[model samples]
Target chain A: MGSATPVDDEAALIAQLRAGDESAYEQVVRTYGGRLLAVTRRIVGSEEDARDIVQDAFLNAFKSVGRFEGNSKLSTWLHRIAVNAALMKLRTRKRKPEQSIETMLPSFLEDGHHEERFKSWDEPVDKALERAETRQLVRAKIDELPDGYRTVLVLRDIEGLDTEETAKMLGLSVNATKIRLHRARQALRTMLAPHFAASGGGKATP
Target chain B: MKCRELADFLMDYVSGELPEEHRAHFELHLSRCRNCHEYLAQYESTVKAGRIACGEMSDELPGDVPEDLVKAVLAARKLDPAK
Candidate 1:
């Protein structure tokens, strides 16, 4: 299954699979299973859950394959299913409302870590490495971003969709997407700054 | 436009979404302002870091995904109505 090649002719495969070719179905599964699993894991943040979600996506895709128009690529159609499945799972979970920034700001100021780090700066190269490491420091920061910011970052940055495509996918105006993306980048920058400074590559400015 | 205004628009500038006149105006401000240049660099790095973080995060699946899970997905497809 791991080494299965992408179907050379997705339309042909879909046509065959629609004609009751079980091998074509298997081929589709083998080609897309790992990637779909990866997308699911990113959204659900659990291997078991991701597996279930991906399986559900495949099942849904199979059930609806005959109705699929050739308007979108087969992979895109499959990924849309995966995204929908992931979003449905995410919806089932309860999430606490975000605290107001005014309430949270004082606690951040009171923290010695923030105070000490913001007091100083670092050289540029060290800053870059530190920024890189911040990716591992918290797994859920992206998930915690405001919904508008999170959606843009996830679609454009994480999912590797371009602005135009992301705009279309999210049903947002391009200007709205740009604003969200800018704010998301800024928010993530603020979160990672201390780590970046500590990594010693950021050039200290007066 | 002031450097402060241009700084706020830096991301759009880098993304090439700014109108030609605005792009020209922003660059004109950038050329003369050291602080804005540095700020722009930091902003660029921040965006780059965000992109890298996303890529790294996506690549890092829990190392212990059970082989059976994939098999189960494959097995489910056998009963697929479309198949």
Candidate 2:
């Protein structure tokens, strides 16, 4: 099929698979396996674990493919399975001890001064890229944030999902997602402020 | 709405989820408030930086994935009846 086809071929492919067409199942796996592996690696943070998770996800998808009602995109359905698998794996691992929410709030409150630190986009992209090392620094800092804030930022900002989509994926209210994203941004700004100041970035434009 | 109130609503505003009337209220307040305006600009920039960082790291994932794993996945799929 050409790239411009109108109807979603995923449903048709699934139908073919159910009808015992082997090529359709292979086509689905070939198309989505890499992407699913990448997402799993990001969530699980290990190549070995990601491989296992992707395999399990594929097995689960194979079993449930018949039950898929064509309501959601196939990619999204596969994504949900991968995410669920990774989260289950995470639960079984030894997690870092939980930090108190009270302690988390004070650090976020102290980040109120974060507005003073960005250079506007008029700067050259090369220069911006050089200065943008703060992104790496900020990601490391994101890892330090409370689990609640970190997960929302990863799902929303990093994964490029919209707030409603993220809320649905994470089982949160829309307002709750907004608040978490806000706090996550504030915390990141606080984390990056020092690097921004060190690089002598221009004051944020009003 | 005051700056604090606007700050409370800014995420919803940027996300474009606020009701039209509330959004209008936010813009009216933003028109008069320099600090909130700067705050919004900075917040947007931070989001932009986060996106760039995520894109860069995500791009790295493909290179890091073992080629053999991809081949194995392809081989496994070839045995499926639907594929």
TM-scores, each model vs. reference? 0.72, 0.70
Model 2, stretches more than 4 Å misplaced?
A: A1-8, A19-26, A99-144, A158-165, A196-206, B19-25, B55-58, B61-65, B71-83
The CA lDDT at A34 in model 2 is 67
Error of 2 at A197 (Å): 5.2
Tens-digit lDDT track of model 2 for A87-185: 668667887885644422212123343334344335422244354454456556666666667678877887677788888877789889878888888
Best by DockQ: 2
Q: Residue A94 error for model 2, in Å?
A: 2.9
Judged by DockQ cut-offs, the docking class of candidate 2 is acceptable
Instruction: Point out where model 1 deviates above 4 Å.
Output: A1-4, A99-147, A164-168, A171-173, A199-206, B53-58, B61-66
Estimate the TM-score for candidate 1.
Answer: 0.72
Q: Distance from true position, residue B58, model 2, in Å?
A: 5.0
| Residue B43 accuracy (lDDT) in model 1 | 62
Residue B65, candidate 1: alpha-carbon lDDT: 37
Q: Positional deviation of B11 in candidate 1, in angstroms?
A: 2.8
- Compute the interface RMSD for candidate 2: 6.1
